[model samples]
Every structure is written in C-alpha cells, then in structure tokens.
Target: MFISAKNIFKNYGSTQALSDISFEVNKNELFGFIGPDGAGKTTLFRILTTLLLADKGSATINGWDVVNDFKTIRNNVGYMPGRFSLYQDLSVEENLTFFATIFGTTIEENYDLIRDIYVQIEPFKKRLAGKLSGGMKQKLALSCALIHAPELLVLDEPTTGVDAVSRKEFWEMLRNLRDKGITIIVSTPYMDEASLCDRVALMQNGKIMQIDTPQHIVGEFPRKLYAVRSSNMYSLKDDLLHFPEQHSVHLFGQYLHFTAREREADILGLRHYLEGKNHQNIIIEAIEPGIEDCFIELMTENSASNEN
Candidate 1:
C-alpha cells in the first residue's frame, strides 16, 4: 500500500472535522477525495502529510508512520497545500530552484519529472510569483512539489481557483506523472474530476459517504431519477418540491433532477401535473445519475440519519 488511513478523527473545539475516516491507496494509483468545501478533505490531507495530528486513529505512508516517522514520510511524499504557499516575491524559476535546494536536490536532477508542467510557465520564469496568473502560479507550485521526485504526491484542491483550461491541463499532467509510477492523492470539490481518478472517496459532513471507482459509485444510485426542465425552472422546481410524491429535488445546471417517493415513477402523471400548473415546453426524461447527483443523495441520507 502506498497510503493507509484508519479510523482517523479530528476536531476543532466545538466542530468535528473528521470522523472515523479510513481509506487506502495502491501504488501508482490516482485517488481522489471528492466533496464540497468543509468536507474534511484539507484536514485529512494535512494529517496524511504529517503537518497536523489526528485526535484518534493512525495512518502511514510508504510504510512510515505519519506521526512517529514524520521525517521519513516528509522525504518520501510531496505535498501542495490548498493555499498557494510559495514565496510570492520570488520568480517562477527562483521558486522551483529554492524548493529543490531545500530538499538537497537541484532542478537539473529532476527536470524530467516536472518539465511538461514547468515548460508551460517557463516563459514567465522571470515573472514574480505574485504577478503571475492563477494558472501560471499553480503550474509553478506543482513544479516545485515534484522537483524532489518523491514516491507519492498529495495535492489539496490544486485547481480550485484556476481556469477551466488550466484545470484540464493539470489533470493531464497528473496522469502523465502517474504513468511514471508516482502515486497521487488529490482532493477536489469539482465532481467532474471524480471520473479522472482511478478511484474516489465521496465525503460529506466529515464522513466518507462512499469509496469506489467513479463508475461504480454512480452506478449505485438507488432510485430512478429524471432531468426536468420547463419554461420557468424556478417555479417548476418549487412545484415539484411541493408535490407529495417528490423524494428529491435538486437543480442540475439548467435542469432539475428529481426522484419520486416510489421506486417506479409515473412519467405521464408527472407531465400532466406540470401541464396543469401551466408549465410550458416541459421536458422530463430519465437520465443517468452523475457524481453530483450521487453526492446530493448521500448528503440527504446522511442528514436524515443524523436527524433520526
């Protein structure tokens, strides 16, 4: 195993940050922690990277305990935190060189590992980190993280504030890195990125709701769902929520995804009900569930259980 976390728990005063969290990652695998903000992704990443202690449970990286063998783990793992923590006054090239130097290495020693990502920002080598664009800064940060050529890489929301194009490019770089035999553990609030990972752990409210391949997780959605759209999406959603049969109602992009109280839904009856409500150009059809859909269902279930 490249990474192992068992029954981890963390709290901050009155707030519970993580609850009995447990998971593992195989060598060279791209594992993702998929969740919205405050789902304990950053907290877990911190504990796994030996930057913080968990109040309960244990974890190991590359056979070294995260707490007792923090030095070894630090040497073996590369971490890029949620916030951009590089020296903003330094240039891109300067930042990379500085990070490499700290690890007792030179950029020339591991240029191949980060060449692809670094080249994208190389033209801005002279630009101060603070003056670079968000995407450029991210690229430089990733390059710094890889200069040490560690066995494992841990990134926390590396794409949070970047552009769409940069985010896509970043994932491609991660894939290329994984192909070179470096295991990766990344956390993202973007549900779409879940598919890019070999496996993902969906988290909510400090607990893991599900952990499996993206396909398997989405395949496990327990109810028939439909994408419904009308001339007035807002009113249509409110009306559906008010309907006695609706089990779940969530807005998905320009449409509303809804499920019924019964396992099997009455499409004709639903259409008729909408027509009676003066909804125009109504479109309601069964569609495949997505990661976001599954997360929402899981969150609803978690809340219901807590309430009960």
Candidate 2:
C-alpha cells in the first residue's frame, strides 16, 4: 500500500474531528475521500501529510511512518492543501521554481512529469499567483505539487470553487498522473467526481460511511429506487416525504429518488396517490442508484442507528 492508516482519531477543543478513521490506498491507484466541508477530510489529510498529530492510531505513506519519519515523509510526498498557501505575490514560474529548489531539485529535473499539467498554465507563468484566475491558480498549485515527483500525492479538495470545464481538465490531469504510477489521494465535496476514483471513502461527521468502488457501492443500495417527477415538483417532494411506504425520499438534481419500504413498492398505489392529490404530468421510472444515492442511504442508516 502506498498509503495506510489505522484507527485514526482527532479532536479540536470540544469537538471530535475524526473518529476511528482507517483506510488504505494501493500503489498507482486514484483514491478519493468524498464528503462535505466538515467531514474531517482536511484533518485527516493534515495528519497523513505530517502537519498535525492524530490523538490515536498511526499512518504511513510509501512505507514511511508519518510521525516518526516526518522529515522523510515530508520530502517524499507532494501535498497540495485545500487553501492556496503558495506565495500570492510571487509569479507562477517563481512559485514552481521555489518549491523545486526547496526540495533540493530543479524544475528542469522534473519538467517531464509536470509538462502535461504545467503547459496549460505555462503561458501565464509571468502572472502573479494572486492575479491569476481560479482555474489558473488550480493548475499552478497542481504543477507545484507534482514538480517534486513524489511517489505519493495528497490533495485536499483541489477542485472546489472552480468552473466545470476546469474541474474536468483537473481530473484528466490526475488520471494521466496516476497512469504514470503516482499514487494519488484526493478529497472532494462533489459527488460526481466519485466515479473517477478507483475507490472512494464516503465520509460524514468524522466517520467513513462506506468505502468501495463506485459501481459496487451503488450496486449495494438495498432497495428499489425510482426517479420521480410531476407537474407540481415541490409539492410532489413534500407528498413523497409523507409517503406511507417511503424508506427515503430526496431530491437528486432534476429527479427525486423514492426508496420504498421494500423492493416491491406499489407502483400502482403511488400513481393513484399522486393523482388523487391533484398531481399532473407525473413521471416515474426505475433507476439505478448513483454514488450520491448510496451515500445518502448510508448516512440515513447512520442517523437511524444513532437515534436508536
């Protein structure tokens, strides 16, 4: 494994940021930590990158212990934090050069590894890091992170706040990197990106709700689900919430996933109920679950268990 952690725990003042966190990433795999803002992703990344100490448990990257081998880990892993921590006043070229120099290497030494990613932003190398657009900043950060050619790369929500096209471009670059044998561990709040990962750890409130290939996770959704829509969209959702056989009902983009009490939900009864409620243009179809659907199901189960 390129990255591994066992029973990790973290806290801040009166709050627990992580609870018994554990996972492993194999060499050359694109692993994702998928969750919302406060899901302890940043905290876990910080611990793995040797920036913060975990209250318990241990972690290693590329066979080096994160704590005891702090210096070696720091030198051997490329870390791109969630926030832009590069020197804002510095030019893009200058920032990349500075990082390479600090690592006792030159940009020319690893130019081949970064060329594919760096070329997109190279034309604006003279622009100040702060003056660059959000997309450009993202590229520059990625380029700097890869300039050292570390065996393991850790990125925390590298795609947040970027445009759709830029996000697509960034993930493509990651794929190319992983193809070249660099193990990558990235975190993202966007559920759609989960499909791009070889495996994902669905996290929430300092816990991993599920960890599996996106296909397997969605396949394991334990109920028949339907995408439901009607003329009265808002009312349709409200009515579904109070549905007699509803196991779960939540909006999924343009459609609402209606999981019934069992796999054999009453389609006829559902239609009749909606029609009786004056709903028009009702459309319903059995649909396969997506990563978000699976995550929502796991989160619901966790909530129910806690309440019990």
Candidate 3:
C-alpha cells in the first residue's frame, strides 16, 4: 500500500472530527475523499500529512509512519492545503523557489516534474501570489507542491472555488502526473469529480460511508432510481416523500431523484398520485444512477444508523 490508515480518530474538544476512519491508497493511484464541508476531510488530510496527530489509530505514507516518521513524511510528500497558503507578498517564481530551497532542492532539479503546471503560470511568474486569479493561484500552488518531485501528492479540495474550465484543466494535470507514477490522494466536495478518480472513499460526519470505484458504487445502488419533475417541482418533492413506497428522495440539479422502497415499483400508481394532487406536466422516468446518487444513498444510510 502506498498509504494506509487504520482506525483513525480525531476530536476537537468534545466534537468528534473523525471517527474510526480507515482506508488505503495504492502506488500511482488517484484516490479521492468525496464529501461536503465539515466532513473531516481536512482533519484527516492534516493527520496523514503529519501536520496534526490523530487522537487514536495510525497512518502511513509510502511505508513511513505519519507520526514517528513525521520528518521523512514531510520530506517525501507534497501537500497542498484546502485553502491557499502560499506567501501573498511573494511572486509565483519566488514562492516556488522558496519551497524548493526549504526541501534542499531547486526548481531546476524538478522542473520536468512540474513543467506542465508551471508553464501555465510562468507568464505570471513575477506577479504576487495574492493578486493571481483563483485558477492561477491553484496552478501556482500545485507547481510549488510538485517542485520537490515527492512520491505522494496530497491535495485538499484543489478545485473548490475555481472556474469550470480551470477545474477541468487541473484534473488533466493530475492525470498526467498520475501517468508518471505519482500517488495522489485528493479530497473534493464535487461528486462529479469523484468519477475522475481511480477509486473514491465517500465520507460524511467524520466517517467513511463507502470506498469503491465510482462505477461499482453506483452499480451497487440498492434501489431503482427515477428522475421526477413537475410544473411545481418544489411541491412534487413533498408529495413524493409522502408516497407510500419511497426509499429516498433527493433534489438533484433540475430534477428530484427518487428511489422506491421496492425494485419493481408501480410507476402508474406514482403518476396517478401526482395527478390526483393536481400536479401538471409530471415527468417520471427511470434514470441511471450517478456518483451523487450513490453518495446521497450512503449519506442517508449513515445518518439513519447514527440516529438509531
């Protein structure tokens, strides 16, 4: 395993931040931690990167124990935090140079490793880090993180606030790096991005709900799903929830993604109910499940288990 976490636990005073977390990442794999805010993604990343200690359990990166070998881990891992943490007063070139120097290396030494990302911002090399646009800042941060050519790359929500195009480009850069055999562990709130990873660990409320390939996760969705919409979409959700055979109901983009309690649900009965409720232009059709659908189902199951 390139990375392994076992029974990890973390707490901020009385609030549990991570609970019994455990997962693994293989070498050259692009593993993603998928979850929303306050899901303990940052806390777990901090622990794995040796910035913080877990209240319980253990983790290792590239065979180095995160705690006892903290210094070595720090040297062999490139960590880009969730928030931009580069020097605001320093120019892009200066920031990259500083990081390389701290690692007893030079930008020229690992130029090939980061050239693809750095070239995007090379034109703005003299611009102060803070003045760069969000997308540019992201690229600069990634370049600095790669300046040392570390074996493991840890990114925490690298695309949270960037434009759509930049996000796409950033993932492309990551794939290129992975193709060169760098193991990457990234966290993101965007479910759509989960599909881009080799495998993903779906996290929520300080726990991992499931870990599997995006396709497998969606394929394992227990209930048949349907995309439902009506002239009054808002009211349709409430009505669907009130229906006798609802397994789950979540609003996804422009439609309400619904699953019935039984696989062979009565579509006609559902349509009749909606019609009786005076809903017009009702559209209900079976649709393939996506990452978001799997995530929602896992989150719902996790929540219900905790409540019980």
Candidate 4:
C-alpha cells in the first residue's frame, strides 16, 4: 500500500471530527474521498500529509510513518490544500521556483514532470499569483505542487470553485499524472466526480459510509430506483414523499429519484397515484443509480444503523 490509515480518530475541542476512519491507497492508484463539508476529509488529509497529528490510530505513506518520518514524507509528497496557498504577491514562475528551491531542486530539473500543466499557464508566468483567473491559478498551484516530482500527490478539493471546463481539464491532468505512476489521493464534495476515480470512499458525519469502485457501489444499491417527474416538480416531490411504498425520495436535478420499499416496484401503480393527485405529464421510469444515488443511499443506511 502506498498510503494506509488504521482506526484513525480526531476531535476538535468538544466535537468529534473523525471517528474510526480507515482506508488504503495502492501505488499509482487514483483514490478519492467524496462527501460534503464537515465529512472529515480535510482532517484526514492533514494527518496523511503529516501536517496534523491524529488523536488516535496511525498512518503511513510510502513506508514512512506519518508521525516519525514527517520530514521524509514532506519531501516525497506534494500537497495542494483546499484553498490556494501559493504566495499571492509572487509571479507564477517565482512561486514555482521558490517551491523547487525549498525541495533542493530547480524548475529546470523537474520541468518535464510539470510540462503539460505548466504549459497551459506558462504564458502567464510573470502574472502575480493572486491576479490569475481561477483556472489559471489551479494550473499554477498544481504545477508548483508537481515541480518536485513527488511520487504521491495529495490534493484536497483541487477542482472546487472553478468553472466547469476548468474542473474537467483539472481531472484530465490528474488522470495523466496517475498514468505516469504517481499515486493520487483527492477529496471532493462533487459526487459526480467520484466516478472519475479508480475507487472512492463515501464519507458522512466523520465516518466512511462505503468504499469501493464507483461501478460496484452503484451496482450494489439495494432498491429499485425510478426517476419521477410531472408538471409541478415541488408538488410531485411532496406527493411522492407520502407515497406508501416509497423507500426513499430525494430531488435530483429535474426529477425525483425514488426507491420502493419492496424489491420490485409497482411503476404503473405509482403513475396512477400521481395522476390521482392531479399531476400532469407524469413520467416514471426505472433508472440505474449513479454515484450520487449510491452516496445518498449509503448515507441513509448509516443514519438508520445509528438510530437502531
């Protein structure tokens, strides 16, 4: 394993931030932690990157103990935090050079590693880091992180707050880096991006709900799912919530993603119920569960288990 954590726990004053968290990442694999804010993704990343110590449990990266081998890990791992942390007043090239110098290397020495991403932002090399556009800043931050040629890259929500096109392009860069034998562990609140990872750990309330390949997680969703819509979306959602056979109902984009309590749902019966409620242009069809659907299902299951 390139990265591993066992029974990790963390607390912030009186509140628990992480509870019994554990997962592993194989070398050269692209692993993701998918969840909303306060899911403990950042806390866990801090521990893994040796920036913060865990209240309990232990973790190792590349055979180095995170606590004792902090200096070595710092040298071998590139960490791009959730927020842009480069020197704001420095030019893009200056920032990259500074990082390379700190790592006892020069930009020219590791230029090949960051060539693809840096080229996109090279035209703006002399631009102040703070003045660059969101996409350009993203590319520059990534270039700075990669200038050392680290074997493991840990990015905490690297694509957040960027345009859709930038988000797509950033993920493509990550994929390219992974192809070159660099292990990457990234965290993102965007569930759709989970599918882009080799495997994802779905997290909620300081715990992992599920960890598996996106395909397997969706395949294991234990209910018959249907996408339901009508002329009045709000009313349709309310009505479906009251439906007797509904296992769960949540709004998803333009439709209400619904699951039946029974393994086999009565679609015709559901349509009739909506019609009786004065719903117009009712459309109800079975649909395959996506990463969001699977995440919601796991979250719901976790809540139920806790209550029980």
Q: Please give the distance, in angstroms, between residue 161's alpha carbon in candidate 2 and its true position after superposition.
A: 0.3
Residue lDDT tens for model 1, 253-281: 89999999997689999999999999999
Residues 1-308, model 4: lDDT tens digits = 98989999999998999999999999999999999999999999999999999999999998899999999999999999999999999999899999999999999998888999999999888999999999899899999899999999999999999999999999999999999999999999999999999999999989998889999998998988899889999889889989999899999889899999998689989989999999999998889999999888888888898899
Candidate 2 lDDT tens digits, 228-290:
999889999999988899889998889888989988579899999999899999999998888
- Total backbone collisions for each predicted model: 0, 0, 0, 0
Error of 1 at 139 (Å): 0.6
A best-first ranking of the candidates according to their TM-score comes to 4, 2, 1, 3
Off by over 4 Å in 1: none
lDDT for position 232 in model 2: 88
Please list the C-alpha lDDT of all candidates, in the order they appear. 0.94, 0.93, 0.94, 0.93
Top candidate (TM-score): 4
Clashing pairs in 3: none
- Where does candidate 2 stray beyond 4 Å? none
Q: Scored by Cα lDDT, where does model 1 land?
A: 0.94
Determine which window of 10 residues in candidate 2 has minimal summed lDDT. Answer: 256-265
List, residue by residue over 70-137, the lDDT tens digit for candidate 3. 99998899999999999999999999999999999999999999999998899999999999999999
Task: Report how far residue 289 has shifted in candidate 2, in Å.
Answer: 0.9
TM-score per candidate: 0.98, 0.98, 0.98, 0.99
